[model samples]
Target: MQYDSISHFLRTGQEHLAKGPVALIFAEDDVEINTTLRHHLDLGFSKVVLFSPAAFNIAPELAEKCPRVTLESPRGEPMFDAVNAINDAAIGVWLYYCFNSEYLLYPFCESRTVGEMLTFHTEERRDAMLTYVIDLYATDLETNPNAVSLDSALMDRTGYYALARNDPDNHNHPKERQLNFYGGLRWRFEEHIPADKRKIDRISIFRAKEGLKLRPDFTFSDEEYNTYASPWHNNLTAAVCSFRTAKALKFNPGSTFQIQQFKWHNSVGFDWHSRQLLDLGLMEPGQWF
Candidate 1:
């Protein structure tokens, strides 16, 4: 089914919304939009909802597989408003949100489905999952000028760090168990990126509930919702190997010329295996063996 507006979809697509573990792909300008959709579908999402303009011209075969909705692309605060709108209507469903060219990878995703991970997460009494945006770029920028190549994807195997997340409302006392992660492209291209946008942590996967709110910083309204790990143990953490930042660096007219190349000696080929992220401590596997 198709809708001209998000409101229309919310009002009419109740059956699709009822399904759990729904993946929302808000395609901004990703050249790898199809791959993004395919990744989510392959991960066994109960339903995949796409919010993009008709100009994206989603392939016929892919469009036929999921409900497509027409939405004017958002600017300024990214997709905060659009994602929140969907979250408001997605109560009781485990929702995952990301832009095009961003892939959702959880611990041990190679042999397991996202559903299985969420099931174990739910069993641990967790309603939200923490995910870090690990920037990925093509090693050969000229060959893949768009900065996205599933075949030649590369990521920094090191350089990730975390700083205490300070709460202004609480007189600057640091939030418990929450840290603003930084590294990847956001680190290398700091001059072009905003301070708030530099944080790499995101609460992208969560079980939506009444009054649940996603802030501009990729955190939720509930304090605990912003945590990166379960209170009792070191629960699993996920990462999104995103080309969004690399795309911006290469495409943004102001910064494009400044960034001559994205590759460096530290870059390593992404083996497309969870083990690489696990070995680097980028994502935790929790109790799963």
Candidate 2:
């Protein structure tokens, strides 16, 4: 169902989510997922699922270190089907799903607990999008002062926009907020693209309770257009999508679509979807938590 405002969306039986559980799903390659799981478990996440490509390089023993981690091997099944299994079995559950490379930035641990984080207003829940700040220097955890800068050039080249930190926010919370930094520069992307388009690279967190359906024909490509498909996104950008909305897209993981289009900002589908959500009045500013 479509919503005109956060309040309207909240009033649509979405209020039931306030008491649900929250889960996080990460891919096997994501080393940061280990850290994120530790943080979440400390905050009280009861169920966390890890989906790994059968050939993932990370050692299973490493993932086993986290008590809350539950690994799922997506070897032969389609991606959506795997996600659906989690959603169906875990309905009434809130999800903060993301790649191993992404980290939670706001409502930090010292400032709030996992229980407190899940207590979002219906409007906030419906319009809320999870955003990641790239810590190019990996200083978010070490220094009290954190820096954040928006790199438009990188956005231009990689089709993804990133924020870097030169200074720090001395807000004084519990632990220094963690940053995902396995690659040369430690950073994360928030992938929130439209449902109709192809390819997405940004990390995302979703709420399973919303019941959004995903389109089975979902596919991605590097070229602008394919013989049987449309260009995913001409701009190549990504953002976090609502769990309900993401489910509605029904993306097929096993399709022959090229993974090259999956990089940040190379797929236009997410950019258009972001615009559509804003234009439809379905999204609200300051809603990202």
Structural similarity to truth (TM-score) of each candidate? 0.97, 0.39
Cα error, residue 280 of model 2, in Å, equals: 26
- Residues 8-30 of candidate 2 have per-residue lDDT tens digits of 32456243234444544455343
Best by lDDT: 1
State the number of backbone clashes in model 1.
0
Candidate 1 ranges with C-alpha deviation above 4 Å: 74-78
Pairs of residues clashing in candidate 1: none
Q: What are the Cα lDDT values of the candidates?
A: 0.87, 0.34
Instruction: Report residue 23 deviation for candidate 1 (angstroms).
Output: 0.3
Instruction: Indicate the TM-score of model 1.
Output: 0.97
Q: Per-residue lDDT of 1-289 in model 1, one digit per residue for the tens?
A: 7878788888898788787899988888748888899898998899988888877877788888889888777433546776777788878789999888999988778789898999998898889989999999998888988888889999998888999989899999998889999999899889999888999999989998888888877899998888877778888799988999999999899899898788888899998888899899999988866
Model 2 collision count: 37
| TM-score of predicted structure 2 | 0.39
- Give candidate 2's error at residue 138 in angstroms: 7.3
